[model samples]
Target: MNLVPLDLDRDLELLHAWVTHPRSHFWGLQGADPQRVRAEYERIAADPHHHAWLGLDDDGTPLFLAETYDPAHSELAEHYPVRPGDLGMHVLVAPPTRQRSGVTSAVMRAVMDFCFAQPGVDRVVVEPDVRNEAIARKNAEVGFVEERHVTLRDKVARLSFCTRTAYAMSAPHLQPAAIAYAHRRLIAKAIAEFSHERLIEPIAEGTGRYRVGDLAFTARRYALNHWVVDADSLTGPLDALDFIAGLRETLGIPEKLLGTYLEEISATLAGTAWKVTHRRESAAELVHADFQTIEAAMTEGHPGFVANNGRIGFGLQDHEAFAPEAGRPVRLRWVAVRKDESLFVTAGDEREHYLAELGEPTLARYERQLRGHGLDPDDYRYLPVHPWQWEHKVTVTFAPDVARRSIVPLDEGPDRYRAQQSIRTFFNVDRPERHYVKTAIAVQNMGFLRGLSPKYMQATPPINEWVRQLVDGDEELRACGFGVLRELASIGYTGDAYHRTGTPGAYTKMLAALWRESPVPRLAAGERLATMASLLHRDRDGNALVSALIAASGRSAAEWVAAYFRAYLRPIVHCLLRHDLAFMPHGENLILVLENHVPRRVFMKDIGEEVAVMNDQPLPAEVERIRIDVTDEIKELALFTDVFDGFLRHLAGILASDGVLPEREFWALAGDCVRAHAKDHPELTGRLDLLRPTFKHSCLNRLQLRNTLQMVDLTDQAGSLIFAGELENPIAVFG
Candidate 1:
């Protein structure tokens, strides 16, 4: 492709046709005549800082239009600080006469190349209309980082920038060396996690040397049967697909699910490749970064599941548009659900409070839309929908309802959100105080189809209210500054087809949303929020974020670990011993509020789906679904398997590998926290044993390997747990 200076008289006809097309509505010239189109370009031609160009194919045929200007002299200068070498750009591809793939992307690359080839250009700037989701995604594909929305005279625009380095890092082709490196790392993790689950027992050749099939690697076995494998020492094929296929029988992967499992492994490898090739910050930089920055920088997904990022329904474009690592701002799709078919529940807030979250303008606009449809706004409730879900599932599966106006599709919400690491949940980046909106998308990820059950949605807010009261009443929990982020409101639309069948399958759970309290309002002075998962994040260079936090805190590694235990682990133990309650306290389920680079307290979330009440305590009828009858052994595994083995074991390996803290010392600090808690509550001491010599080994990957669709029945979690044998408790040695 080549760029030629646009001719005023000759290009007028072509520019008019391009801008007047419906596809170019964002250009704001949809009904322009020939005279208007010519006058606009004539104005640009007269400006010293603005220029227009026509992109031509090698055969000298016009394919697209491009514009360039200096941001220092443009309207953008009023919105953001203008750097010395900031060059603003705009591109519009002509409506295609034939279907073509990669044409738009090629045009984008050529435009970027043309801008950088100029004498003084170091970065490219764009202010596409905020409603143009397509261009925003394409911009991200070429490394544009969405900064924020800027309101202009014509429309609200997303101000984004792309540096030369960022463009280079987002090159379409993956580096061969990077792909090899990613494969080696993933293979090592697979071996470690699979062996830890006792699926493929490695033959012990010598101390620290083991062989799985023909692949030989060195590893050290730690407490909880954890395998810390050496990525550099693996001697066999580094292909994850071939490795999984070879061990299919040993891993007990069913023949029918083998292909799906392999696809997940490939996707995981691709995600890793993207991370390594991108411009990732160092651990020290991330330690001082903001919450969302730390969230997007996470490379590891679950730490235990090998195929953690399956995301089966997401195509490549979906990954770029919606994935957390992409760091692109998203605007949720809104729809009106008929009040009779939908369930809306709230903890204590009224409907007006939830409606006010949309702000007055959006709320008024939505109500107007419902009236336009000849439907009463009072008979409907507005619900947030994941953009992907709106496009893929709702439009297709609920076509009859939409046609009958039972589910009326509305425009995108005004506020921009960022996808959290959990993928389905979104954080309000535009308005930090707004509640987090969690929508259900029918995508298969991790061990189940990621959807919110309407049956569970009915009880979500009440369960959150119960848990909030419990946390508020506990003196020990309050002393540690521990709290729960309540899920205040929820709305779920049950389809007529599935509701009549009375089966709460994935289909019935597809259209539901919940509003949870944001952590932003809970921040104290000098305190910021970071996901607890950030503690386990390692940069591409192998430096641990936890190590960086310790360095920043001006404290010894042991001191920092002790503080972390006090803020995180002690409250978890208190909840279990004093309340007979257990939460799935994985790193992703908790948020750490840090003051001066130290964890001052924690706020637990995902309360409704994860929290379990083990004892047969009397509970409110509305919140009785959380109650579960389990044996003492299963209740003990709540700490042994969920907390120690699932979360802390990975943290221990990260710290040990970084040489910041030894493994033994880490568990000793944890044991000290537990003993202190036990001593404070003598009546609860014998109810559960924290220092048992061994605990049942609950295999996570085994659960997925056995059944990828639904790993375990949520209703019978205790009975569905897959266990191998037993693991020696690291805390037992400290006792």
Candidate 2:
């Protein structure tokens, strides 16, 4: 492609045809006459600060129109401060004669290259209309960081900027230094988690020195078999692939699964490298940042899993467009499925919920689309799908349904969503109060294919409703503001061909989604939301976000942790002993509501699949699937392994390493919280032992290592757990 100065007279007809097309409505010149187009270009030509260019192909055919101006002298200066060397840019691709792949992206890259090539240009500014989400995503592809909305002369626009350094880092390949840095950090994590699980025991060489194979590192042993490995002190191959390969025998990874495991490791390394190169905020800055900002700023994923970020099906482009850490806004693709072939369940009026989720205008548009396809709107239900899943899986695997009009593809939804750390769930960034849409994608991530079982989704809402009522009726829970983000609705499409296979696997579980309640509406005045995973976040400079939050709250580290336990741990304990219920309250599965940077309460999510009634508690017929029979010993592991070893041990290690709090004090505060809760409810004091000396060590990496495809049976998770011998309960000493 080539860029040349656009001639107002010679290019007038071509430019008019391109800008006046209906698809170019965002260009703000739709239905304009040729003369009107000429007047606009003439004004730009007369101005010394602005210039227009025509992008042409090898055959000299016009492909796109580009514009550049000096932001200091433009209308943008009125909204925000403009730096010296800031260049403003706009690009509009010509209406396509046929469907072409990567054309718009190519044109965008060309425009970015042209702008940065200017003599004084150091940053490129763009103000795309806020409603034009397609253009906003395109802008983000080239590394534009969105600021706030600015009112321009014609429309409200999202002001964004891209620095030369950021654009370079957004490239597909990482710099050598970044790759090496990511490898060292990942190698350290692998060593730590593996040793903790007793997969590869590190030989003690000297004080705080250990050797794994030929690799040597300095690490401190903490409570609950935790290893705090120092990344800088690690010596040997810094490549995560080689590191995993060296321990394949000891990890007990089968020969057939080794290659796939290595692929996961590579993907994890690439993701870490991208985050290391593109991180924009420090730990302190994230302390005051908004909810989504702190969420995407999280660097570590599932402190236990070594290959936690192994999005195996995503290509380089998908990583940039959908990865949570990428911080890109996404628009979900909507589809209409025949009512007979789909199931829709809700806790409230379905039509009213749909109208709110997809505004009235969008709902009307979708109804019109169905009528155009010669189908009645009342005969079908609407469902949202991940764009990647729709393009890659639905279009091909469900072709029979598409061809028969059982599943008709509609346009993208208007609201923009951001992928959460869980990857399948999305938060509505455009409308904060809207429900979180969790879609199914048949991509293999950490331990299993990330697909929602449509059969199981049938009872999701009822299970959530049951749990909601239980929490509301508990006096202590209501006082603490501990609640759940209910999975209020669900919809799933079953294809005829795959449905008859009688197999329950990824293929059968492809097209399903659930709507979970958003935490935004539950917030009080002066309160903010942050994912509990942010507590484990350490910035590129080795600063902990949790430590920063403690300092901001004007409380000592011990005091802040005590408050956190009240908000987070006490509820889980209450539900277990008081209600005979167990929830998978891992960091990613929880949300913390904060005021003045101190956690006041918590919200648990991912309910239908993760929660269980461990004992013989009577449940509603619709929610009976959650009932699980387990041994008393295994029931105790719910707190000992999941809460203590899985989550708090890691938190203790981080605080101790940062010198903010001692591990002993951290465990003591936790014990005090549990004891205080027991004191308040005297009848529940002896129901469960909180100070057990030891509990079976539940191994997470072992599950993934055994079967990278499907780690555990969803229906019998507790029965399928892989366990190492035992771990000493950290809080036992407090008793």
Candidate 3:
């Protein structure tokens, strides 16, 4: 039985059917005609707390009138804590099919699911006529824990109330969180596999506590300012930000610099919003909406490497096949490179969000749909996924860790040794000879170089047909998925330094594809959570929850990450930057190192949560592993601006003295970052406000802001000189 919100406009029709039936009471509209029943339903619908809906059997036949309400909304506000979050519930099962044993029971389950889903709902109560002892007893069969006869709803009726715990008792009927997690896990996997992947699913949904299938993630999503928090530490919402602010102040950094830092961080967070979504009916919605459209866009023709299993390897496409500029550099791409210039794959952005809009039901339905989809009824996975939530997906990649001896050899120069940070990227289905294209420039800080981060592809053309054949009827995707993984192990991309064990990136991409399919903002109260980090509060239970999360993450990978930071990264930062490298450059572009082929051991946490904090409170245990979040792009840009001016000058000085770097190669590394950013993002047009005459030298180009970056260069005519020649005898102004 599906008990969702009632369409008041159609209530009278259902009421007429019920009243004319064999068992229903006056609810069937006997004394009051159909019009009167419709009028009453409309009246209740007008109020937020009162609602009426028809219960539908599995076959879509309307079985009963399932109505519910808050006693507080019925002139009984004084009886409850109407402090906004609190809610009270009342359920009335009206019928032609009154005591059909299982009908009412099923309807009651549906109502319970709805009640528990109201955000911050504390308790739900149902009022039945005190004389209806039969219903009072039936409530127990339907899983009502605290059923009692009491006055409620401004009426002298026996009332039944249920807490979250009571609602959880129907766990067997709800969808398991593992399903939602599988979706999220796949999203992260797709991001690793595909290009320009964003929105790794949250480690946990925005519940009061932790969730299952929450893989290796340190940052958590609990309220920060809980009254029950212990005084020994100020760890919660603003813990990371507050720590960074205090660190800067204690170190006595000039506010002039701090202002820019704060502004950039704020803007980045504001621009790149984090999001979370859990669709209970996503599978059905996809089927109804034809999700296969995405598959067609990504992989129609390419039959990737045929494995020993006899199935052609297939991967997701970056875009549509008929798309313009088929090989244009995009976040992700599918290509068959006959030669360097012949690389091609059906490619284009799949419009997934639009489809989602057409398929998704209202929030009230989402809860029922989710629960209905799950095997367990009490599982909160049935709850709507939190939209626009903060999450961090850390990518671990490392090349051979360079000891000091190794570093000394690379330096092969004066006390000042130089290393550049470069990024190597690729998309799905490649050949043996295609090594990562080395970018033209590098950052002065070796610490900022990223060797590996979560990356993968193959969302389209779902797993090989052979795997589908071998994995079998029930194990189709799962068995095939595990089998291919073993093959990946053979190729050195699934274990240890060569690879790591985790969900395939295809899952992550499919999720993003799903999000893109439904991009509209369907939020309650129209709040899209405008900021990446919003300040929230929790009670004692919430505080304990946060503490537990912190302790868990801290004990897991957090300590290992922290230790890695100290071992290889810390000394290099201090020894290299005698000028005092601010914040260890780990916001976005600032955190990276090559240990194996993967970029591993990055420590970027505890920065910029509290803007006005003035204490030395210890950092929260949650601030451990950090990665490129929504704000990483802009924050990293800010980090880039911080070091560009000084670092470029140093590079020019050394290159000039050594005279080994080609003129073009020398200038290549100078402003390559900003240049690449400009070329990639056309939206920043007219935003480049470079310093006047700062256009000639890459040094000044590096210091400009997005709103102020001019992409022009400047040089001091008399002092300026390019490689292979000197300036004119007269004053040569740089421009």
Candidate 4:
């Protein structure tokens, strides 16, 4: 209702008109006046017992009156014994709108739901005359049942009650506007396309090599959940060579000496051939490869302990890690298959989920819709499989003889297999705040290519999703930088200040509906704080450089430096690192970002690849709390390394060769971090000592020790670290 306070006198006149008129249905009030209306409204407005708000339709018109009566209020001090989960609420339609079309019923239900949604109230109560047959039916439709009638203020009224359990039984009145449904449908279609492109298309044409559909789309792995080949790809230019030449020509490549710009990486897969013979499922295909190289792409250096993203080398059939920096000794494992070699990462765990979750049991429920929509699952299932490894990835390679003879089984296996998730016990331990907080993230400032140039749009903030989590789930939006923008009101925002311009404008009051439902959640900043801190402290030596500096210098100097950083720097680094956080831990803005990663407090510093618990007095049961339940498990995002040398490796060469900052500057950066949050969180400020390490502590400048030092004498003692590595060629430069 525009969220504006009701015009009490006007509303009273309208109500009085309805009741006194013989045509009135719900109300038959004896009397009401301007003064009486003001007095009643004041009582409601001021009454702690009553929570009153107006309901508005999609167009922001006032729809009805909504208010809740909860027993916990200070005014309702002697109110009846309210249960741990209980609430009461009601809705009165604005007169001249006698149609109780689901909206009013929903309004009443929403008020009751809001009451129950609060931490305490649970049950809702309403009273109406039983003789009003229409209202009785409406209340019943809203999951309200007739209780006993009571004489209150010497007036008999039939009482009714509603419960959370019963709200679902009632039809919901409040709903997303039609536009929202349209948007959701659009999004769903996009998701469908991605699923089809990445995990469903069969007989897809490869840019290199011939299209599998050339021999008819009878591949056995067509139903598998990887590398789906879109049949459309079959019609494109034959190979990478053709595609590249055409691309260059379109980009206006000079005709002269075009050959000098490009080089062939590998010979064509055209020589290799595959065909689908009589197949049970189209996913089955027999392939013959004239193999040259069959090794996994080194996306990561090579991981031995797959859980920890690290480098590993092949030691015959066994795997050995070559971290040369880990010192002492390197570890080796005898696992049969590495992550890259396998079509799916894990077979047992993810297979269990696939078979149980989106498996037949689940698919059956949606099969009618599937069939009704004319979906052939097999045709839509082979998208993400590499052209060569499509079927062989999940099962075994099929020879022409076997393909012609053996009946292929359905492609039933896992795609993203995680061994850690196989166990029934291990779940949700990753998030300590699993019970109370529900989280979501909005991709803010969404800049996408509208035509050619990218245009900016904002996501409807995920605050509503966050509020839902707090009310119904355990997740939360831990993403940083959630609410820095102004309300959509000002110019460049919402132009509601100009009278003529603002007349048909967005109202802050009405926007409250969106804002109320969509609350910008307080970033549950601990994990991000921890990750950022780790990045700041990350030294090539695998220790924190900022920590070491603060230990050497006293707190006061650190305070001054930290002040400059917070005021002049951190914000920029925070914004930049947000997207590529996996790599941001590197000192990107040089020491600028390192200083920004500093946080006010460090709750979980010991956090690493593994999860652990460390509370003062061990809350044994707390670890198994409902928050971290079976349905909730954290997925690791540190699976890929899209970097060549990495930040840690380069720091030493850069510092020691020709471009090192002075030792004093190092301390200044550490001091800057210490001072950033010193004022408000003094305890954390005091713990600056805990951050530092002694030079002799062995976890010293890792990059420095890795190579010989090249020093350039600096007059300013603070710049010594910078001057040390003043080499024309440092170890690694930021790419």
TM-score of each prediction: 0.79, 0.80, 0.27, 0.24
Q: Give the TM-score of candidate 4.
A: 0.24
Any runs in candidate 1 off by more than 4 Å, and if so which? 1-175, 205-207
Error of 3 at 734 (Å): 98
Candidate 4 residues lying further than 4 Å off, grouped into runs, are 1-31, 71-84, 97-101, 171-735
Lowest-lDDT window of 10 residues in candidate 4?
Answer: 286-295
Evaluated at residue 577, the lDDT of candidate 2 is 90
Over 4 Å off in model 3, which ranges?
1-9, 19-22, 26-30, 46-49, 55-60, 75-84, 90-102, 131-134, 141-143, 151-156, 172-735
Give lDDT: candidate 2, residue 26: 89
Q: What C-alpha lDDT do the candidate models reach, one value each?
A: 0.89, 0.90, 0.29, 0.28
Best by TM-score: 2
Ranking by lDDT: 2, 1, 3, 4
Which is superior by lDDT, 1 or 3?
A: 1
lDDT: worst 10-residue window of model 2: 168-177
Instruction: Using lDDT as the measure, name the better of candidate 2 and candidate 4.
Output: 2
Candidate 1 local Cα displacement, residue 291, angstroms: 0.4
lDDT of 3: 0.29
Candidate 1: residue 536 Cα off by (Å): 0.9
